[model samples]
Target: MNIDTIAKMLFFATVRIENHGAKSASVGTGFIMTASLENGDQCPMLVTNKHVLAGAQQLVAHFIPRKPEANVPDLGQAVAVDLPPTMYVGHPDPTVDIAVMPLAPTLLLLANKLFIQALPLSLLATELPDLYTDAIEEITFVGYPNGHRDPMNFTPIARRGITATPLQLDFGGKPMFLVDGSVFGGSSGSPVFLFNQGTYRSGPNVITAGSRIALVGIIAQTMLRNAQLPVAEEVAATAHVKFAQELNIGIAFNAKAIKESIELMVSSAGQHLATAATGDGVTELSPA
Candidate 1:
């Protein structure tokens, strides 16, 4: 399989999150990003939805081991690192579904054995130039949907769709937008991107023939349809609910929310680096 440079990078950028709780086991998606500090230091963080990390007895992050001689992932050989509970940090606002966990200690353990692609904050589309001319733009997102991935290669799957809501405006008066894509239960925290190659719109009547890529947002929730029941006085006492139908639409928190979440984590008494051994003997970092 010949993967392009962009696809390969995106594949490596994502890490599978397995949440094992007392009742059941669930899966979700997360991507690596470099959070910049005021002191000019860059820290690699695992960005994902807060709900994905909630109620988990233990969290394991799956990563692809790198083949040093070939400078590529070993594919079949994967590594699982247990993440400590203290490592999780959520957005200051309880309502925000975004959270970030530091990866410095995890990277140290991986060392040269695993390959990771961390995107910098500069990629966040604080301002989408193309949005000025077009309200509906195509987007690409990478993740493990419904916990499905390459069984042999251990890589993330990429999906494409268009923006259902304008990127500049907050959807439903929140810092979010909608994507018309086949988002599933395990796609939370997937990074959304706006990728264009060849000719793209630059202005109202100007077209630029070049490539552009921007990190527009991150997947937070998938819209689902609940069947409406007939109103009855006894409905509240003996209500039986059916499974919600997938709407094929995903709600994503825009880049501004992501930035704000990072800032909130950083500003809270500064990020302290504390090293501790997990139950499985995996090294984890706890930020203050």
Candidate 2:
């Protein structure tokens, strides 16, 4: 896709996710990813943080409908798909907060009813170009903050920040990095990207005049700091603690973790496909 199309497509790449529990409801973000299979099949999957769906009795994904004539989103014509919790498959490693859900079945049901622009797996940055340690690239993350989004347009809020830590090294001995931005509760599962158009530096003293984009990571946690509590004039026996203040730094799991999570889902589906092909106690399986 051209740079302008790609940039515009990024706006539709994410869906505002609402987690509904028996007693309460919460919100977060989720993005669609198109994973290519070895069998020449393309599977669309919804990617998000595991915690976003935790304790969710029903998950609702808000999607924009397509205008048949224009083949573009119909803005105000938004549709929501309420799904059971069983549809989500989380990372095998409990520590890995990534979760993925196959979108083929859902799309098949919705059929030409919705307009979704999925981010291709090619956008995942598995490796970085040669760069020195001093390089600090600009990053952009798309999501809803504080459960806020354009209710009429169904568009997410895009925020920009810089890498607070080196992408080459795992931050805090984990497969994650830090970003300096205004991250909030509902921003979890936001896809962090590196998008440079027109011109970019390929190496030291080298400027390349081309467009570049990559899915660098996914937001998981926001850093916080406890503030000192003030003493009461009455000097009560105990004082209630206030909520921690946001440090405006976000913790994002790197692209490799996302690739691994998608692979896990794909491999599981592939195994089922192989079994079905053999006609050996195999049942019809949907993409995982």
All models, RMSD in angstroms: 8.8, 7.7
Please give the CA lDDT of all the candidate structures. Answer: 0.78, 0.79
Q: Write the per-residue lDDT of candidate 1 for residues 58-177, one digit (tens) a residue.
A: 999899987878556788878998887467678777877899887777777675888776776666675333343268989999999999889998998999999998888889888999
* Residue 130, candidate 1: C-alpha displacement in angstroms: 8.6
Candidate 1 wrongly placed segments (more than 4 Å):
1-4, 127-133, 228-243, 269-288
Model 1 error, position 82 (Å):
1.1
Per lDDT, the best of the predicted structures is 2
Candidate 2 lDDT over residue span 153-233, tens digit each: 778899999999987778988888999999999999999987777876665787777666778899998999988676685
Model 2 lDDT, full chain set: 0.79
Error of 2 at 149 (Å): 0.7
Consecutive 10-residue window with the lowest summed lDDT within model 1: 279-288
